[model samples]
Target: MTPPEPLRDVIARHGLQASKALGQNFILDRQLLARIAAIPGEIAGDTIYEVGPGPGGLTRALLDRGARVVAVERDPRFLPALAELGAEYPGMLEVIHADAMRIDEPALAGRGARVVSNLPYNVGTALLLRWLTADWPPWWQSLTLMFQKEVADRIVAPPGGGKFGRLSVLAQWRSHPSVAMQLSRSAFVPPPKVASSVVHIVPGNAPKDVAARSIEQVTEAAFGQRRKMLRSSLKSVPAALAALEPLGIDPQRRAETLAVADFVALARELG
Candidate 1:
């Protein structure tokens, strides 16, 4: 059988261009996409939930790696191309025409599906927050997502760094997150102004007896006024402020100085 047309050829034939409004920047390099797909480890016959699969580039890579992909794409312009890909992959690819933000991922992808995507820049952080705050032992098995380098840094940042804030605490408190790979700005068709990185995250043991909301509440309050001392910043969350003393966290410390474990401890004390 003849080899399938290259992704660049498919994009050219279809006159498809990345839509700026949708935060689309198409990556035609199959090698890079394959590397990204590999970051989630072995996935033969596993279900992958992909968001913003513009022109089906990453979707194709995941399918090639023997994953069954359910792709959520909001841009109607790329659906035809994605449909063509679905035909090639038969039952392996399922395309959903809907905004990923509104999709109930657990209901759609079912429990324990791996979520892999080159997420749209505009909504990536919001989606990550949603996933991070989902019920304990979230529906997804793992998250392998591409984000702008700054956001990726925030996801994996450690305490005492400028990048360490609410995102760092939330991501680290319940999961192991790492920068799986970095991609240059020039890698995309319409290269983004900033470099990008893929973050690999697998769920870890959440602190027992601590509600996820309590952690979110504490982080939001603490980081909301990050420049201030914890006693001042956490004033809005009286419970968190009250718990700080009993937990032996210095009231004068800034939010960035506190570790993820400190935040979890505060949340546990909030209960």
Candidate 2:
């Protein structure tokens, strides 16, 4: 068997560098890439959808672990390098040169695939929210994603903390999420300004009869004015105030004080 080409050689050969405009900070550390890859455990034979696989660092790790990868990369500079990886891995890798935000991941991924990416900083939160609120159970089996530590904190944060707000409510309501690993700034070729963490998320049963969009609206209204009482903050959302009384929630309470279950109940009543 021929040895696989080293990532450094591949990047040097292709003259690839991270693009600040695209929020790209390529992870060159092989051990760190391996660690991120291991978060979605038991992925053998599973299809993995990777976003922004610049120079194929983590993409290589995913393929080495007996998984087929569909990697979406927008940077043209890295395409040849990734194409080389595709050739090395043969049918195990498919490289798509397109923006991740516009693509229909579910349709592209089919069913039973897992989403694993070292997401670009600019679109990390938007992409996560898209996946979370997607039709349940989400088409993807699980999400192993990288994000700024602050954003990751919000996703896995429990109720009552300052970090617990709209995102905290929405993510916990529909999925089980935890910070799987923390990567320091030094891990990347051009370190990001903020620290990063990997979040491992698995789909969970949404509240019975409650729609995800309703939860999004309820949380948006409730946290839009985080400092105000629910009565004041939620006034813009019709029936939100009216639903509070029947659910036995205190209108005097602020958004931060409400539990995940409280938000679910509010969403159900709003619907």
Candidate 3:
């Protein structure tokens, strides 16, 4: 059965507009929802972790695809609607009312599960960072998420690019990421200011000698100032030189100039 569109009209009638602070942009297109769900390689029979299933739009889409959805919604305003969805998809939609950022995600994706969502533009970067550098690799397996086009560029950026920053380092260090789909502003019920795209990331084992922690530390320092070179930027840490020494990365080089692997190496040397 096609999911309910009438609920959206009802939601708007009640003045339940998308919250900019929460980065809530509801997806009304059925085909788009299906595409987002399909991001985690072979989602069939795989459990899905969905953040912010506002009015159960994406929730219904995931359920229709036979994937069990663990939706974490923060807004109580939509709980009643979600509850109704739970009834419709028995033993499938597990709705939790909480802030997705604060909630422990790996704990949520028990067994063979995947991260799938039209991510809130506001918290998208934070959530992506948390999941990408997770301690365990097969924890969620893959992430299919939406972000502002700019954020998407940062995630998939390479060395010496403007989008390259701590985010670029962190995301590329752990996963192979790519933009799967782009949606225009017109796609939403009440359009947002910026365009958005779905980013699909497959988290696999890191390359040899890349400690996730070190990459994090180095990237933080490098992108902290963002204007200064590595040597100048890392002045906060007394042992910064020791960390950057072994990697053969120049102290004069800017953070954005370094590739993901270089950042990983520098991070390891930090200790």
Candidate 4:
């Protein structure tokens, strides 16, 4: 069998360049891609869901690891290259050309599929929130996603830190999230301005009887005015404010000072 073309050669052959508008930054290093594919752990036979697979760089790594990948790509320009990759991998790769934001991921990827992606920067946070807030015991078995270093810090930040806020609370309240690896800006074909980090998250015990929306509402109210005391910030959410005193939480505390459990408590109280 003929050896597959190198990623750089593929890009050159396809006249492909990362699109700034699409938040595309291609990672061509096979070793780095392999490391990323390994973040979710032991996926030899597991199905993997990927997004924005520009030039199929990471897709190749996942396929090489014996993973069956369902890759979503919105840009038509890269479809031909991806089609070639799909052919190379034969039955292992399924390339879907659609906007990932509009597609029904759970239905397409099915239950217990692992989500691993070098997410597009423009929609990274919004996509993370979507997955985090999906129906309890989310469809995906795990999430190994790449994000700007700043956003990664927010996801794993602890209470009392400036980075800790709604994202931190939501991520931690029901899951274990940690920075799996850090990548320098130079790792990309056209380097992004900021560094990047990969975050691996698996579901943890979520508080029973507390609705995810309630947590979202409470955090929205609190962090919307993070500089103000909880008593002042949560005033917009009367139930949240009233619950604070009853729950023995200091009304004088600022949002950033509260822990994930505190937010869950507030959400439970709001119920």
Candidate 5:
């Protein structure tokens, strides 16, 4: 097989630089990118969806792992570099020049694919939330995504920690989320201001009786007033308030103290 051209050479050849406005921080380290690629293990035939594939660093890694990649990139500047990579591995890469947030992800990559990306910092959390709220046993088989460490902590945070809140509840309710790897700030080309980590999420069976929307409502109200007791914070959502009594949960408890299952039970009662 032909070797893919050097990524740095491709970038320089295309006169490309990471765009700060787009939250772009290109990961120039091939070994580190390979590690990110390995998170979706044994994915040879899987259609991997990658967002913001700046200069195709991780993209090449994914292709090297034998994944057929659908990479959605907003930055047109990196297209030529990506195209060069595509040529190296014929029919292995599909580069979409569009904003990931605006695209129909499931329609683009189809169902049961793994989503793996070094996501743009600005849209990372929002994108994760979007995927999380998708239909039970969501379209994607798994999410192996990079985010700022703080956000990664929030996603995998357990109850009682300061990082545990709405994101924690939602993420844990219908998925198994864990930190796959931590990356230093120096890993990127221009380097992001903060350290980053990869969070691997595999969808689990969602509570059949509860609406995902209801869970969002419950957590939003509960965490929106996190300092207040559940009785006070939940007053805004009568369903959640009503749930506490039936579930034998103390109304005086704060949001941070509730388990993910507790939130799911409350959401079940909300319907």
Candidate 6:
């Protein structure tokens, strides 16, 4: 395998191509990858999970920064190139051949592992949902992830914002989410049409007032008809509103108007 080069040259040398089907876009920015690795504390002694690390560009950066990276790559075509990375890092890189969607991450990560990846555009939101919706907090201690700019906006959306919706509700319900960096199309080898942004989330224990899964269900139903008033929109979730009866929730309020605590109360009421 050829040694990596300036991000663009590396792509040209190996006949490397981005697969639209896989939602692959190669980042040429070394500093950005390093920044991601650094976000969840020092890399050393930390288990870092990177999904779809095509060509191991980010893998190299993670390893160089001293993090133990468990890289799950779905594309076998990139295996040879990734094998070279494993060779270089030796015990530091563990490359798995599996669809990230199907893999059992909790078992793989054990404890103290963090999910940090550039993320495959096609499956990014789905994967984020899985991590955020896990039963216990700290399933992955934190998430340093990339998403299309639109998704990023949703992740960091504040109450009453147009971009705020289900993603904002779910993500903010457990983790303190923020946009760490904004990336341009030119950063990737095959420039994507839209800009991208990196989101960093550090999950904490949900307040004792609510259960995690319950809030999830309530938010799903409430935001499902996000534009409608809660009284009208949440009518489908009689159980949720009934649960909130003691809390004196105004049935007419919409999902966006409700805070995370309110959703938790509604979720509990529904349960």
RMSD of 4: 1.0
lDDT of 2 by residue, 1-271 (tens): 7656677777888877778888988887787888889999989999999999998989999998999999898888888888878888889998888989999887777788999999999999999999888899889999999999999999999888899989998889978999999989988878889899999999988779898889999999999999999999999886778889888899999999999999998888777
Q: Which structure is stronger by TM-score: 2 or 6? A: 2
CA-only RMSD, every prediction:
1.0, 1.2, 2.2, 1.0, 1.2, 2.3
TM-score of 2: 0.97
Question: In candidate 4, what are the lDDT values of residues 1-271, reduced to their tens digit?
Answer: 7756789999999998988998989898888998999888899989999999989989989998999999999999999999988988889999899999999998889899999999999989999999999898999999999999999999999999899999999999999999999999999879999999999999987799899999999999999999999989998889889989788889999999988888999998778
Weakest 10 consecutive residues of candidate 6 by summed lDDT: 2-11
lDDT of model 6 at position 44: 75
Task: For each candidate, give its TM-score against the true structure.
Answer: 0.98, 0.97, 0.90, 0.98, 0.97, 0.93
TM-score for candidate 4:
0.98
Candidate 5: tens digits of C-alpha lDDT, residues 1-271: 7655677887888999988888888887788889889987898989999999988889989998999999998888888878888998899999999988899998999998999999999899999999999887789999999999999999999999799999998899989999999989988888888999999999888778989899999999999999999999998899779879789899999999989989988988778
What are the per-residue Cα lDDT tens digits for candidate 3 across 1-271?
6646665674765557788788787877777776766666556577899888887777777888888889999988888888878998788888899999898776776955788887777788888877777775657767888898888988888888788888887777767889998989988866998898888888756776666776777678779988898889887654655667666777888888877777766666555
Where model 4 places Cα greater than 4 Å from the true spot, the runs are 1-3
Q: Could you tell which candidate, 4 or 6, scores higher by lDDT?
A: 4
For candidate 2, the per-residue lDDT at 68 reads 94
Greater-TM-score candidate between 2 and 3: 2
**Clash count of each predicted structure:** 0, 0, 1, 0, 0, 1
Evaluation by lDDT, superior candidate among 2 and 5 = 5
lDDT: worst 10-residue window of model 3: 1-10
Reference-based lDDT, each prediction: 0.93, 0.89, 0.78, 0.93, 0.90, 0.82
Residue pairs clashing, model 2: none
Consecutive 10-residue window with the lowest summed lDDT within model 5: 1-10
Candidate 1 TM-score, true structure as reference: 0.98
